[model samples]
Target: MVQNPARRTALADAAIEVLAREGARGLTFRAVDVQAGVPKGTASNYFSNRDHLLDQTARYIHERLTPDPVMIAELLRAPRDRDLVKALVRDIFRRISEDRAGYVALLELRLEATRRPELRARLTEAVRDELDANVAYHLGQGLPGDRETVVVLYLAMTGLILEQLTLPEVLGTDGLTALIDAIVERIVPAA
Candidate 1:
């Protein structure tokens, strides 16, 4: 209900940090206020309730994680082939690694969503939209993959990211890159 966009975004961003550091249980309005360095009750003013805060924070994280259009355009200038697909997927992992907190908070939201139907519905919708967009982009670019290929890569990347985040020692840096290359090589047909 707050009309101040910047202030609302700041509150939502703070809520993400709280969710990342403290999990969903620790993401209270007061926690967000402290994280944002704002007056007490400031978060409460911006978010009608905890659900509202979580919803906005989820959206904010997605927006933050979106690749820059300029970067995407630059990548597109290269030939659309298996190598390009690997590069694109590699860029995705790089972005996720760069925003480790955002991804962790997203995982927390997934756990919270399992217990909250409304949040689950919203996340489901968001996930579906992202999947659809990826399929569309891959097809439109004439990339070496169909929808199913893209879907498989999505699942593979999801698993890789999960392992990288929770068990970094399992994959390490070199293993991660090797796995990405292997997935792309096996999944995307050679052009």
Candidate 2:
């Protein structure tokens, strides 16, 4: 079907909102229909099933969460300075803070991935691609290790994000900044 960009964007936003507010259990055609202000069966017409809806929602969240081109270019071009890394880390934390609901939806998707192998594979590949990109950028700055280091750091960042999401005040801006500083100090210390 030829979908209007505005309509598709609205439906996608509504899906994310529903998934965030209600988790996987709360996601339904009716709820999305209400959220999107579309008639019943509209969402189903676009997304044949709940799995399809969730998959698209996951993809949307991933795109929203992934680092942007400007940041990627900065990371690629900038020197291996500890301050630069810290700044990047702080920006990352800020973005996560701004999109708490999306992060929560992603967490729900991660759990669901475990039970569904196909979803799990997709999730794994997505994570791996992200890590590879970051690893390549860091390597460009003369960081050590190969794919393994990138994977480990990616996992570590995920853990940090989860902690921030669960305990935002505890991992407040200052605390998270300090944590990132420490990580940068360890990984890319000043000369």
Candidate 3:
């Protein structure tokens, strides 16, 4: 079968929605096909099996959530300081909140990885690469924090994003922005 990157991506994006709305157990080819509004068996036509479909879903989430280039350029032009740190982190969290479905799917993917070593390795590499890329981006922009700080900040923010997305009541209502500020203040601080 001929490869159609666009179609494949559409299916994977739909799978992300399914993974978020229904979770790991709800992620099925038929669900994806239905969510994507494609004919039955369309997902199978592109993906060999569930693993392939899920791997593609992870890729889709990564691509979808990457920091926007235009926004990055704007950040680069700004002075390197804690204010910039807050701006970058706030922007990231804003995007995360906006794409709650994709992030929820990612959470589900993380849970699924524990039972599937292949997925574990794949997600681990992807997250590591993302961290490295983030560190590079910060350095290129002369932003605060070294690679080590960025790694720690990433881990911290991961937990925050999880709670903020899934169990907001745990963190309380309408205070995530302040939480992000506190996290940045402790981790990166005023440059």
Candidate 4:
């Protein structure tokens, strides 16, 4: 259906809230409407079905995230070294910890993808594109090595993020910063 960008964004954001709080099964059209404080059929008008709503929610969350340009610029001004990598990692983890539900929604999408092959392929492609863009971002900064190094760093940071989000206490109160520093030192080769 044709909807204004603002209206669609609002509906998708509301749908994300529903997905985060109630999981995929509970993300009904009425639920999104209620969450958005719009009329009962508003979300239905914007989205043809639950799949449309869910896809929009996933995309909305991704659109709203991605490291801030200003933050990236500021980081770029700093020396390209281990500390810089730590700063970037810390920025990522900080954002993740702040928007826990958004990450939860993404994780839920991953789980739901297992049962939906089309969604799995779509999400895998989307994630791969993002990863490639990330590699380019790293190389553009004149960071050492190739995409493979960045990919390895991505995996390590992902594990740390998973642990931090799911079990912060497991990191032993050293917190995101210290853990971030450790990973940057260990995984990121000196440039």
Candidate 5:
């Protein structure tokens, strides 16, 4: 099948909107078609099934979340250890804030993928790759117990964001940053 990049892009964008607004349960071919301003047949033509469409959407979101080479270089080149952690935390918070909808959609995808083996494998692999990369980056910089530290920090950050999202009054941005800072302090130690 000839790949129409424009149509694929349109479908993926529409899928994000639908997933964000109505969640995984509300995703449908007709809804995507309406959201994308394309016919249902056209949307289906690009993604033959719901699974195919959702898988593509997951890939799209993962690509967006993965840090690029320039971002990696900037993180690696930061002047101080604290600065490195701060930069990483700041970037995560920025992404979470700027694309709350997308993140929420990703959460939905994770939940849905539990029932679909292929999707579960793909999402799991992507997440593992992300975590491994983070661990390797810190280890390369001589951070202590880098793999375990990254796992702990990553979990803490994700948990904090989830709490902040669900209970904004209790976990404000400043409080979240403080929590992140405390975690980083424990992991990186003072020089």
Candidate 6:
């Protein structure tokens, strides 16, 4: 197996694009190599098997989706109020919107996971950990709202991102930012 971290990341990212564009059925080593502009079998060199490739792709998506610490720090400096929650939610939405491919690939992974118990378990654990980490971060940072609030926000944002990506028409233009504001204003307690 290849020992290059950069090469592995490239293959994983290419796999993400393949998944987003072609779904699980189309994610082959050759397809990843083509997408990554690498020689044939390059993906196979980095990943032992299809499941291994899928697992690494999932990890890469999570790594890309995590918020930047500098951005988080900048946002955290704001008042710990519902407004802060709104800002954070907005940032989350922005990140997802910017990385549409990664988010879409993640959705594909979710679908693929339904047919593979091992993948399902891994995704479940990863998502739960992310949720817990967000909750912990919120509490540790003195942010308004509790675990319930974060959970609700997570669900709401997930739905919003899904709709926005798959069918923007479902959420008319007027209801976009206004809707986010409403969610935070109602769920996040004013401090």
Best by lDDT: 1
Model 2 clash pairs?
none
**Backbone clash tally (model 1):** 0
- lDDT, ranked from best to worst: 1, 6, 3, 4, 5, 2
**Candidate 1's TM-score:** 0.97
Could you tell me which residue pairs clash in candidate 1? none
What TM-score fits each model?
Answer: 0.97, 0.84, 0.94, 0.93, 0.86, 0.97
Error of 2 at 133 (Å): 2.3
lDDT of 2 by residue, 1-191 (tens): 43676776677788888877887788898999999999888888777778888788888887777777787677656655556666777777778778888888888888888888888888888767766778887677665545565565566777888887877676676666778767656655454
List candidate 5 segments past 4 Å from native.
Answer: 68-72, 141-145
Alpha carbon deviation, residue 178, candidate 2 (Å): 1.3
lDDT of 4 by residue, 103-171 (tens): 877878888889888778888888898899989988888876678878988899778767766687787
The positional error of residue 181 in candidate 1, measured at the CA in angstroms, is 1.3
What are the lDDT figures for the candidates, one per model?
0.92, 0.76, 0.88, 0.81, 0.78, 0.91
lDDT of 3 at 173: 58
Clashes of each: 0, 0, 0, 0, 0, 0
Kindly provide the TM-score of model 2 when superposed on the true structure, using C-alpha atoms. 0.84
Query: Which residue pairs in candidate 3 collide?
Result: none
Span of 10 residues, lowest total lDDT, candidate 6: 169-178
Answer with 2 or 4, whichever has the higher TM-score: 4
In the predicted model 5, the residue pairs found to clash are none
